[model samples]
Each structure stands twice: as C-alpha cells, then as structure tokens.
Target: MANWNLKSFDDIYSSIAESAYKDRPNSFPKLFNKNKSTEIDYSKSKKDNEGQITKGGGTDLPNGGKVYLQPDSKKLLEDEETGYNAYYVTDTETINANTHQTYFAIRGSDGFGINLPQIKKGNFKEFNYQDWINNDAAFALTDAIVPQAKYATKGMKEKITELEEKAAPNAKMDVTAHSLGTMVSVQGLAGLSESELNHVGKAVLFDGPDTTASLKKAGYSDEKLKLLDKKLFIMSILLIQLVCSIVINHGINN
Candidate 1:
C-alpha cells in the first residue's frame, strides 16, 4: 500500500480501463505480488508435543480436544491468502479436535496489512466508504464485501454454539485469529452467554483489529466476555508479537 499515492492509484485505474495503457507497464497485480511469502528463519524440524509443522511447510494442528476436524488435519495444514478482492470466509469449521477440547483458527481479510499507509489509524470504514458501509466490517474484514458483518456474526455464532453443544459437556475451545478473523471471533463470541464464553479457553490474535466497541455494541463487555485471559497479539501496529506458533500449540495443550 506504500505505492497507493495519487499518481499510483491513477496509474492502476488507467491500467484496468485501458488495455493500451503502457506508459507504466506495471499492473496492480505486478506491483504487489501477493503470492510472495514473507521471509523468516524457521526450524525445519518439528517441536515436541501436540503440534507439528510438516516437512512441506504446512502446520500440523493439535488434536485431543472435544471437537472434531478432518481426519488428516493433524498431518496437513495450509494457509490460503487472497489474490484480488477475494476473501476466504466461513461460518464455522473445526480445525482439529479430541475428547476434551477443540482448536480453531480464524483468518483475516485479504486487504493490505495493518501497515497500509493510507489508513493512519482506525477501522477500514474510517478510511474508505463509510456512509453505506454499515456493519460490513465483518465481511470486508475477511474480504467478503457483498455481505455485511451482522449477518456474518449471526451465522458464526450459530456455528460456534452448535459446536459447543456437540462437544462433550463443558468442552473448551482454543482460538487463533488473524486480521479480520479477530473481529469474527469477538462478534461471534459476544452473542454467546457468559457460561458459553467460559468454554473458550485461550485466544491468539495475529494482527486483528480491536473489536471492543463492536463487541460492546453487540452486548459483550469486558465484564461480560472475561475471555481475554492468556490473550496475545502478533504483528499489530501498536503491540508486539507476544504470541508465536509455539504459543498456539501451548495454548491448546493447556
């Protein structure tokens, strides 16, 4: 988004409108190769305990909780990112499970990271279409802009409650959310009773927006939620990376 200056925006718009617009040969896709992976040194071997990173660079989520996921989930995990204006959103789906608890991860939207220069601060609405945007934060947060956040929250709450009921009595959930995923988690959880929220054990948010107002409006207060214990944030503009992949596995084990 650093290249989102007035001239660059005009260039991209022209590139889309005019096929012959070649003065600037670079298209939006060319300028930002979203497929490019972030560089970081990683251990090639698996660490001990409930989780593992397969040799293929995929995450091996932990199981042994009360919920359920695919049979092969322990052997394979993939991170899917959006290319264009696309979004990977869902109501609810199990990441992995066991007899005592479950583990679920929520992915954020497909837009620029929190570091988007245009958004000096505040939610996406403050920067762009705020008038008619409404509660579209939940969907737009996940890059699913056509649907609004209220509907998404409803569907998600239903899914979470369903999972909670299906699992063993007092079954717990360990949540990991990234970007818009954090909003989804908070909104969905806010709809649940305090007892239900207690079933949620731990949460790890990766660059997710602070949805305090969003949750409070939905009837979830800090006094109501009480789920922020053991919470950690990563890659946030104002916070440090207190939670890492190891913390994700550890959260599940606890």
Candidate 2:
C-alpha cells in the first residue's frame, strides 16, 4: 500500500487559511499624521455618527487621479506641388446606408481627407436612346463598345460619373485600380472628354485583363509588346526561384 503524508496536507491547508486571512478586512485603525490635514476634517458633516458625532465621512476633494485631455485635431491639408488628386469612394452597400454616397476629394495640398456628401435619390438618371450617343451620358453611344469583363453591372458607369464629379474639380486627377477595379477605371477614363483627359496625369493598372479591341486597335505598338514579353519572362524566372527556395526551407525545417 502507498502511504500519503498527512503533514503535507496540513501544510497546504495552513497556507490557504493564511492567504484568506490576509485578504480579509483591515483589523486595525488606519494611522494619520498630526501635522497633515485629515480628509474627515475637510468634508461637510452629513449625519451625526450615533449622536456625539464624527465630523464627516471624507474630503470632498478628489484623490489625486489621472485626467486625460483630448488631443487637438491636426490639420489635414498637405503642402506640396506637382501632387496628384486621390479619392477612396466607398462601394454601393455603404452608399445605401446613409441614403447618400460619401465622396472623398483628396489632393496633395489643402482640402484633404474623406468627405461625406449625400447624393440625392435618383441622382443617376436613366439615359434616353439619343442621350446614349449625343447627350450627356457618362459612357459612349457606340454600338460596338465592348463591355469590360470586370464590370458585371451597368451601375458601374454611374459610379464613374460620381467619382469624376467628386474629385478635385480644378486639379489633375488620375484613376488607378487593382484586378477588377482596373477594368472600370480604364473604361471610365476612356469615356471622358478631351478636356477631362488633359487634367488626368496618369492611370495605373495592375493585373488587369485585355482592354476592348477598339482601344487597342487604335494603336498597338510592337515596342509595347516586346516590353510586356520581357516582363513576363522575368516574372517566370522569379516564380521558379521562389518555388525552389520554399522547398529548400521546408526540408531544412523537417
């Protein structure tokens, strides 16, 4: 038979009992210095403590504690020349929440950051058959215009108009996008009038599919194709190197 130590159990119980006693209410009267003012003397006496009376419960003055003051709002405007305008327009779901679209008009200098503007209902009016070609429709009237694969809905053209209006009206603006965003950005920019194009500094596209055949057909240079092929070759080499490095690292870890 195995024997358990009774002495060990007694020690454990004693330690727990000591801990509980220490955590219990204070057993002695709190001490005070004669020279220092007591909180009781400073406070207004409310009720007499059993008649003969204690002066008061405590001082009305708060104990020294931390009070945090809010930091001042910094100015948003940046001071710079030759800077481009930028906008981070929220998608439609958010636009529906406030019953208006939030248009952020940002430029390199002054008047920077997000601005929420309520676009009235029916802001995007439907175009008549003539409006599609001759009127002030956002997109072109051409029958052969290819629908960009990235933009699945017709509502995208409305969004483009909103972005254009909300951007810095006087400053140069450039549209940029990643993946599906590139498709819409390019189409929107292409539809702009010649005057609007002058204000546009540059457009950046990332991982985007082919543009409409007409857009390319206007001018597809051999030099551009060679540059694209060179980039693809470099990318292939880098990908292979990355795979080899990953395999080597996995073997080392094992």
Candidate 3:
C-alpha cells in the first residue's frame, strides 16, 4: 500500500497541476481512472508550466467567467496543436439519456493559464501556490472570498450550478477538480440548495487543500442533511494506502 504525502504545499499543488486537462489529454484519464495508477512528483511550480484552465464568457461577465460545458459551436476550447479556438467533441459513450445508470460529470475549476489571453491582458494573478496561500488565508481570516478568488469563485459557482440543473432527479453527479479548483468546488457545493445537493454524490479532489470541513458546511440552513456521517475513503497514491476514514457525525439541531 502506497501513501501519498502532503508534506509540502508544492506536493499538493504539483499533483493538481499535473492532473489538469491541458492541450494534451495527458492528465484526465489518470484522474478519472480507478486506483492511483499515476503518481506525479511535487516538483517546484514553474512560470512556464502548462495552464489547465480555459477562459470563457469574456468581459460581458465579471472576471471573464468560466464555462464547464460550452457548446462546440462557440469554439471556446483551444486546440492542443494549433493554439486556435476549437469546439468540444462529445464522447458518444458518456451520455445516454435513456439509460438507467446516469452519471452527471460536473467539472470543477481550471487552474489559471499563462498563455491565455485573459492572463496576458492582466485580468488576475496566475493561480499558483502563492495565490492559493493568499486566497486561503484571506478566506480563513474573513470568511469571505478574497479579491483574488472572487472572480474565480463566481465563475465556478455559475458553471457548477448549470451542471446541477442538468443533473436533476435520479442522476448521480460526481465532481472532479484539481488545485484551486478543489477550493472552488467546495464553496460552490456549499452554496447549493438542499435539493441540488441531494443529486450530487462523491467528489474526487486531486492535490486539494484541506476540504474536510466542506461537507459540514454544505446544504441549506433549513435542511437536515447528514453529510458528515458518510464514509470518506482516501487512497493515498505514493504507496496506494487505501483506508476508510469515518467522518465525525453531527446533527443539525446541535
């Protein structure tokens, strides 16, 4: 059994950065695949590393916005080879409207990109360890989204909400994200209504920050959702030490 260590913040950040879906299809398969087949090293984050996120919605929406499922018609996705805008090519296998087993895959945040037009134009700081430190510190201190994470969160919330709407009843929505995206997903999920939260299931976070408290914070204030009682299985990749960790249970009335 291997145990992935979160000793350095870089260890965590690098895990996510490497797992991101960039111009290459390099990272997604490993993240989405069962078992920890790939163990990425926590090398020092560099200014030249490939950015996983793609900017969308432009200035019309605050912070240039983010999109989870943009139509192929919009040509928002970038081509890995040409660096030109491209359309999303749907996988015929993922969606089956009539099937009994429905899996709604809701994407989380895409970490910042350096070559992206948004970054070049100076819309915000490149999402890196420093950025996370600043955002997390401000959030822990103020219980508010820092100016740095504000736009990022707004876009994340909007995209996640859209996916939630599509999921509806009888669909199991699983969230997958990396790096700052893990933070964005937690905040977005916490803001969801009790009904929406019901449709969501497990979330697989790669190299994420401390998210143990997120479940306790989710759901409507009036709803009695028992998320804390669920079993949390952490599969550490360094040695693949698989263990079931019980989440502390707490009732709403308390």
Candidate 4:
C-alpha cells in the first residue's frame, strides 16, 4: 500500500462522492482503471448494484484496500424522503499490523445535472430533484431535525458499530463530505456517543452551510460541540477566495 496522505485520500473521496450521481455499471472500477489486482466484492451487492436510479458496488483498491458502497446508498438514492448517501473505504495502509483505518465518503446533493424543466414535467420519476432541493432548504431554514441528517446519523452509527465489532481494537474511522453532506456529517458526528466519537479520527468537510443552529436544536451540548469542532477540518473554496480578497484589499489600503 502507498504511504497515507490526506491529499491522495481527498482526491479519492471526492471522486467517490461525485460517483453518487453517475449511472454507469463500471463507475467504481473506472476510477481505478480496473487494475488487475482490483477485486469487486459482490457478495452483498444486489444485481451487480447497477441501475439508473440506485447504483452501488465494491472494489478493491490497487494498494490492497477495499471500498464498499453501503447498502443504504441505494435506499438513499431511491427514496426521495431520505437524503443520505455514503461510500466506505478501507485505507491502503494500517497504523499497525492489527489496526486499520477506514473512511466514509458522504455524498452531497445530487440532481444538479438533471434537466430541471423536464424533471418538473415528471419526465424522470427516478430522479427527484425536488427532494434534494428540499433538503438544501431544510439545512438553510429550519432546525427541525432534518431527515437527511437523521439518516446520516443512523448510517454512520451502524457502520461504525459493525466495524468496531469486526475489526481490530484500535481501528480508526474518518469522514469526508461535501456541500449538504457537510451538514449531514456534522450532525451525524455530533450524534455519536463519546466512545464512538473517540474512534473517529478526522472529518474533512467541504463547502457546507453552518450547522450550529441545527446541532443546538438537536440537543448537542456546548461541550460536545467543542469536541466535534476539534475533529472537523472544513475546507471552502469560496471562503478561501474571500479571505484572499480581504488580505489583498487590506494591503492596498495600507
């Protein structure tokens, strides 16, 4: 396995997130060029986990790791009422021979690429853009436990619990999420128990709205919020540009 690096993992996680919207049978394999060492795990995959609506499967990384599309992935895609999707990937390298590292690549809002007018006209029953829009609105407007966040919390907890039971004692789990997924991830992480949170290593979120109100509404204490803050590493392209612009303007004024 290659040496562990955040940049390399970030690239892979981003690709996995984007793959949620793709409708191809070989989408996962194509990402890794279907290397000879690559293995597709189909024991739990249904119908090769391919379809226009619900797509899922597993692939072995070239570097001896494995990536599995959680079963909830298909449910999240097929059910408009729920807005959670994720892919779980094991790290190529472990901290020790007995310990392992895993990552959960949570997907953001989909349907952005769909034809809105056609969808509104009921041309695509399988792709519900309105559900995604409603999730976005829920993240922006209300603190009422967003269904998507609830789903995300449940999904993460289940995976973490399962891994804990099966993997080595010190196995570590990380999270990567984008856009609406960031909100989902934050609420989900906040929902974890102290012991579960301890197992979580890092959370890298991208371009998501602030979730303070939602977290507070969900009864996460300030102390717990502080703990979650310590683990989250948020990256926002727009925020970076704004900071750069402010710095440039300040220099000019001086």
Candidate 5:
C-alpha cells in the first residue's frame, strides 16, 4: 500500500535518479549511454544515504518541452537494489494542467526490471483513504501495480474541488483510466459532488473491466451507455496504435 503524493516537479526527478531502469535496462540510453556515462552516476541516487543534487532534472517526453515534477525529481530518493523506485512526469507549459503529469512506480524482480502500467495524470486530489484501498490495483492485481488507487482517487477529487474552490464556475473536469486504475478513477468520480459531476466534462475509460458491473447497477441512461460504448471503442483503437508502435520499437531497438 505504498502511497505517493507528488506535489512538485522536484518530487518526480528525485524518483527517476533512484530508479533501477537508470542503471539496469537503462531505457534512455541516448541520455544514459548504457549506464556508462561518466558525467553522471545514476547509482549516486541509490548510494547517497543523505542525498545529493543533480542538474538536467526532467522527464524526457516524446514531444519537445521538458516536464517537471512538483518538488523536483532529485528530491525523491530510492534504492532499487533493495526494491524502491518511483517517478512522476508533469508538463510545465500549461496552466494547472495535471493531464501532462503522470506518476509511475517501477520495481525490480530477481535482478531484472519491471515496467509500470500507465496511469492517467489528472488534477484530482480529494481522497477517501478507505475507498482507495478497496479499489487499488494492488488489491486487484496485487502482482504488479501498487495500491495507488486511493491516492489517484483522492487526487482527482482534490483537483475538482480545488477548481470549484477557485475560479471557473462553469468549467468541467473528467476522470478516466484503464484496467485497474480505471476502477479507482471511476469510484472517485462517482463520489464527486453533483456540481463536480456537472463540471465533469466526461468520464473516459479504457478496458475498465471491474467497473462495468458497477456502471450497470448505477443504471445509466441509454444515451450515457451509448457514449460509454463509443468511448471504449475509441480507446481500444488508440491502444492498438500504441501497442503497434511498441512492437515496432522493440524490433528496432533489439
């Protein structure tokens, strides 16, 4: 039940410095150079019992602009050799744009690496601690994703509540996710205030297998159900496109 509250850009960077991927598989070899770069020691993040600072802290995105975490990524400390690693990515170009900042938690297995599942980045923050545990991926899959469902649920609710608390009386927010993450996202959305729900532009989802039963019982209108079906199809196609790119990337990389 590891819970992370990423409040700043520094928080995201610190996690990456300590991640196992930096030294092992080292996915970004172009920057890390197969863990052989002399200028930077990825291992320093693991070794420093106290902590150290490093320049060029940002998540390299497929797009151009550099993403920063809340407290700076360098601030997050981890020891991958002993199984501790996490990171977050957030776009800085936009205003209050939580969509660009996504959280990731990676683990090592038997001297190998683990790829975290994709979790949707949102502005939600208000949380129901108990409900999150019940809906967390750790409770569902338990094998991979952590019980982050609560953090994510609370995060989104916070996002919506904060928005209403501030300006934008008419603006809408949406909650969406795939698989295990989807369960918590939807639960939080369901728990939002009616005004929050009204402000919710949409609740998009992808392969949220656990929530179908819930949605069915909630008794959505025919139109709402149709919209959900359409959204599902669109998400499925988008996933297929990404999956294809992954297959191609693997072939090219290997």
Candidate 6:
C-alpha cells in the first residue's frame, strides 16, 4: 500500500501532458510500466463488466496495483470547445479494499506545437486553436472564469459521482494540474459541493496564474474561497514572486 506523494503526482501530470503532444501508444504505456517490470498480469488487465475500465488498456503495476483510463477519456481528449484533456487514474494500494485513491490529472494548453503541425499538414480536425484563443486568452485578460474551467468543474463532478456508483465506494480523489490546467483545477474545485469536496484530497497546481479573480467572478464567496485555499499546494514561478515583491515594496513605500 504505497501512497503517492506530491512528487509522484507531479510526474503523472508531466507524463500525461507529454502524451497529449506525442503519440499515445508510444507514450501512454510508459506511464504505467515505468520500470519495465515483467510482473504485470496482462491477461487480467482487461476492462471489467462494470465498464469502469477500458478494455485492452488497463494495466497492472509492479506492486499489484491497478490503473485504468475511464471509458470516456478519448472523447475528453478530443473536446474542442474546452480543449479539456484529463485522465482518471486509480491506485488500489493507497486505500482499503473497498476504496481506492483516484487521481484526476488535467493537462494544460496544447500550445503552438500541437496546432501548428496540424495546420502545416492541412489537417483542421485535430487543431486546437480554440484552446488558445478562447480559454487561455480569456483567462489572461478577464475576470470571468474561462469556459474550460467551467467544463472541468462539470466533468470532474460527474466523473466522481459516476465512479462512486460504478467503481468503488468512498474512494478518495486528488487533483493535479499544470499551466492553464491549474486554472481549470482551482476554479473547478471551487465549484464542488461540500460533500463532494470532502471526497477530494489535496490539489497540486504548478506554474499557473492566480485564480482569485476568476473564482470571484464565478460567484464563490470569501468563505468558500478560503476553504479551497486550504486544500491547494501551489508552485509558482520566480517571475511571479519577483512581481509580488515589487508590488509589496511599492505599496509599503507609498
């Protein structure tokens, strides 16, 4: 029963992000089989009758832990409106037999790298320009919560409820995100009900802009905002730190 730490979540987030940019077959399998161990039971890795797992995809880890991608994961990745890409990962080792620890790893922006190549090849189907112009730009300039954040909120809640009914009872879910996905994670978590929030553990967000304004615009009260603050572990860049210092110093001088 090995519990994952923040570093483990960080690695998962990075791996998922990379998988979004690269080919899936080459990249996705590597996440579960990192050590190249031969102990995994491939025959038993198929999806169960409950449809909680995807057939031909779920894999057993070296320590007898099981991990699966939810059935709707492919649709989520192909979503153009929100550009929402996420993986619902479960670990059997961290909790009791009746429960498991679930991780919702949300990827950030697809970036020019993903879209530019599609444009060069005259392939508009996979191009994700909406993610940049609509979601990312909106977050940077407005007080309103980006549409992606709203989508994430709905997606996470629905998935959690679905899992509880179909997968396991009382499972603990943790969230991890990077870059623009951090906005999706924070604002999305803010929208959870108290009971739903209880099922959620820590949220690890990396190098994302502050979501205070967006949360406020989304109509979260100060009390609710403070509640979310307690669960967040944010890792911001030095540039943001320096800007904060300058603002604080100037305010003090005034």
TM-score of each: 0.41, 0.25, 0.41, 0.64, 0.37, 0.63
Off by over 4 Å in 6: 1-66, 73-78, 92-97, 113-127, 166-169, 236-254
Q: What Cα-based lDDT does every candidate model obtain?
A: 0.36, 0.28, 0.34, 0.58, 0.36, 0.58
User: Clashes per prediction?
Assistant: 6, 0, 5, 0, 32, 0
When sorted by TM-score, best at the front, the candidate numbers are 4, 6, 1, 3, 5, 2
Better of 1 and 5 by TM-score: 1
Q: Candidate 6 lDDT, tens digit per residue, 1-254? A: 00111111113333333333223321232344322322222223222223233112223332243344443432442355667766555554322355566667777776454566767888777656666767788888886687777667777787667556755676677787667778888888988987788778778776788899888877789989988988888864343335545655787899
Question: Between which residue pairs do clashes occur in model 4?
Answer: none
lDDT of 2 by residue, 1-254 (tens): 00111111111111111111111111001211223311212123322222322122133222111111111122111111212212322222222322122222221111122232422443332322221222112223332223331221222334344445553343333333333333334444555445444454445443344545434553435544333322221112233335545655787899
**Per-residue lDDT for 147-241 in model 3, tens only?**
33333333334433444454333545445444444454455455555555555555445545554343344322423334411311222333211
Model 5, stretches more than 4 Å misplaced? 1-153, 166-172, 215-234, 242-254
Candidate 6 accuracy as TM-score: 0.63
lDDT of candidate 4 at residue 29, scale 0 to 100: 24
Which residue ranges in model 2 land beyond 4 Å of their true spot? 1-170, 216-254
| Residue-wise C-alpha lDDT for candidate 5, range 1-254, written one tens digit per residue | 11211111122222332231333212221232222221222222222222333222234322232433322223232332222322222333222533433323222221212222322343233333222343343344442233333344455455555455643455444443334434544544444444545555554444445454554555545555454443332143244335645655787899
Worst 10 residues of 6 by lDDT: 1-10
lDDT of 1: 0.36
109, model 5: CA deviation in Å? 15
Per-residue lDDT for 115 in model 2? 30
Q: Write the per-residue lDDT of candidate 4 for residues 159-234, one digit (tens) a residue.
A: 6776677777877778887777788788878888888888888887777777888888878899999999989888
